[model samples]
Target: MIEICKKYDCVGCGACISACNKRAIFMHPDSLGFLYPVIDQKRCVDCGLCVKSCFNNHKPTFIEPLKTCVGHVLKVEEQVTSTSGGLASVFMREIINNEGVVYGCSGENAHEVKHIRIENIDDVNKLKGSKYVQSFMGLTCNSVVQDLKANRTVLFIGTPCQVAGLKAYLKGKEYDNLFMVDFVCHGVPSQQILNDAIDAKVADNGNLRLVNRVKEGGKESKYTLRLLKEGKIAYDQAYPSMGYITGFLSGLYYRENCYQCQFARRERVSDITLGDFWDRHDDVKGLNNKKDGLSMIMVNTENGKKLMSMCKDSCELVEWDYEDFIKRNGQLKQPIRRHPKRDQFEELYCSKGFQSAIKESLRGDLNRIRKIILFNLIDSTLSTIPIIKIIYKQLKLIK
Candidate 1:
C-alpha cells in the first residue's frame, strides 16, 4: 500500500501514474490547488513503483553543467518578444528544424498551468516566456515515453523537479536525442492564487489569453505584465505588484516542497538551466550591457552543452563566470528563503478567496504595510500635477 501525503510530499509530477503497472495511483488536488497521488486499495498490487518514481523521496544524482553563458537571441524581434534573451526560442528553432518534439508549460487561456507539446515552428511562441505557477504535468510522462520509444527527438523544458520526474519515469533509459532543460526556479505559486489574480488583473474580466512577464525595456524597463485577450492588450501593468507577481515576489505563495527543494542545490539534474542573468555584480567583461536583460544559460550535462553549441549561430553567446552568476542568483546554490507567513497565507486562501487571503495575511505584516504606505504617499504627491495626473492614469497608478 503506497501513499503520497499531501502538502509537501508529492509534487504532482504524474510520474507515479506512469510508473504504476497496476494503474492504482491517481492525482487529486489538495486544498491549496496542488496535485497529490491517491491510491486505490482494491487494485493495489503493492508494486512500490510509485514510491520509487517520486523525485522528492528518491532524488536524482548531481551533474555539474558542462558549459555556461550569458547571452541573447540574435534576432531583435525574438528578443523583444521573449522574457529573457529569447534563448528558448533559439533552442526550439534548432530542435524543431530537425523535426523534434518540444514539451513545455502552456495554459494561459484555461487559467491553468499544464504541459503542452510543440512541433510546428509557428507554435514555438506558445511555450515561450515564463509561467510562475507550478505546471500541471498530467499524463505527459506517458506521452514522452511513447515518443521516445518511437526514436523521436524530444526537447522537454520544465522546472528541475518536473525534469527529474520525467527522467525518473523513463526508468533510467537515456535517449541521445532527448534534451532536458530546467531553470533557476524561485518556487511556484498555487493555481488557485493564479486564477484569482487573472480575475483581478484582466480588464472587463475578460479571458486570460496569454500570461507573459517580460522586461519591457532594456535595463531600465520594469517588467510589464500582460493579460491579453484575442491578441488584444486588455490588461497591463509593471510586474511585481498588486496581484500574482506581488504575492509571488513577496514570498506569500509557494508550495511547501519549494522550501525544502533538493533541486535548488548547486548541482543540477537537468541538461540545461535557464534564468534571468541579473548580472548585479557587473563583473562579466567584454559583453554588451543590454539593460533590456540577458539570460543565464547554464549547460548542466554534456548533452546540454552540445545542444547549446548548436544554437551559437542563433544567439549572441558570451562566456559567463560560474561563481559570479551564482553569487547574485542564489537559487542556483540554494532554495529561496521561505516566507514566514506562507502557511498563514495558505490557510487564509483556502478558507476565504485569494484576494482576501493575501490581503488579510499582509495586514499583520507591518513592514509590507509601511512600504505600501510610503509608495502611495509618493505616488499621490506626483499625481497632483496635470501632466503627472495623465501619466498616473495611463499607468493605472490611480483609479
Candidate 2:
C-alpha cells in the first residue's frame, strides 16, 4: 500500500484507489480538506500496486517544449465562454469531432466540481472556463485506461499533479490514443473554503447553484466571478472574491502539497501545457493583444506538435518564444511561494471562518487598499457623467 506522509506527500490524485483490484484503497480527507489515500490493510495483500501508482514517491522528469505559442479559438462563442483564450474548447471539439472522449473538471454546483468525461460536443460547454476549486478525481484514471484499451481517442486535461497521477496509474505504459494536457497550475485551495464562499454569496437567495470564476460579457481581463441562485444571477464580482481570492492569493486555505508543488518546472510530464499569457509584453511579435485574453500553449511531445499543426484551421495562433511565454507564466518554472501569514490565516479560518481569514489577510496589504480606493474613485467619477455612462456601458464595464 502507498505510504501517506503527513506533510508534502499526497496530492489527492486518486490513482492508488483506482489501482487497487481488491478495493482496498479509499480517500480520506484530513482537517485541511485535502484527501489522502487510506489503504484497507486486510485486502491490500502486499501487492505493492498502490506504491507503484504513487507520483509522490516517483517524480517524472520534465522535458523542454518542442514548440510554443499564444492562441485562441476562431469561434466567437467559444472565445467568450472560456476563462482566457478558449483554446481548451478547440481541443475538446477536435477530439469530439473525431468521436473521442475528453476528460475535464466541471462544476456540478457552486460547492462541488469533479473531473468528468465528455463524449459529445454539446457536453463540452460544461467543462469550459476555470472552476478555481480542486476537483475530486474519482476513478478517472481507470476510466481513461478503459477508453484507451478500447482503441478510443481520449484527451485529458487537468493540473500537473493530476496528469502525473494518471500517468503513474498506467504503470509507465504509453497509450497511443491518449493525449494529456496539463496547465501551469498556481495552486488549489481547500474545498471547505469553496463551500464557505458559495454559501456566503447566496445568503438569502436560497442556494447558490452556479459558480463561474470567469463569467462572460466583460473585458477578458475583467471576467467576473458569477454566483447564481435558482436560475438567476446573484453575485457577479470582478477580479477576485474577498473570501476566496484574497485568502487564496494570501495563501490562507490551500492544500499543504500545493505550497510545494513538485510539478512546477519546465520539464513537464504532459503533452501540452496551457496557461494565461497574463503579463502582456510588447516584444513578442504577431501576438494579437486580444487583450481579450490569450492562452500560452507549449507543445511538449511529438503528439502535441501534431495537435498544434491541426490548430492552423481552427485557431488564431502565433508562434512565440518560450522565454516570452514564461514572462507572465512563471508557474511554468517555479512553485507558488507560501504566504508569510499562511499558518495564522489558516488558524483564523479554522477557528473564526472564511470571511474572518480574508479580513485578517487583507490587513496591511496596501496594494489591495489602493485597488479598492481606485475602484471607488473610478465609480464615483464615472457615475456622474451622463455621456461617459453610455460609453462605459458600451465598453461592457457597467455590469
User: Positional deviation of 212 in candidate 2, in angstroms?
Assistant: 4.7
Q: lDDT per model, in order? A: 0.76, 0.76
Q: Which residue pairs in model 2 clash with each other?
A: 62-267, 63-267
Cα error, candidate 2, residue 156 (Å): 0.3
- Tens digit of lDDT per residue, candidate 1, span 17-89? 8888888877777777776788899998887887777766665877876777888787878887777778888
Question: Candidate 1: where is the Cα deviation over 4 Å?
Answer: 4-7, 200-207, 217-225, 280-289, 363-399
For candidate 1, the TM-score is 0.86
lDDT of 2 by residue, 1-399 (tens): 446444467788888888888988888776657777787888878788778888766767577999888787777667766777888888888989998999999864666678999898889877877777789998999999999989999999999999999999988898778889998888888566777776666577445544545634544345345676666778775544455665555555678888788887777889998988653222235644465667888899988876777666888887887975665566767888887778877787779877787778757664774688588667756655888756655764443
The numbered model that scores best in TM-score is 2
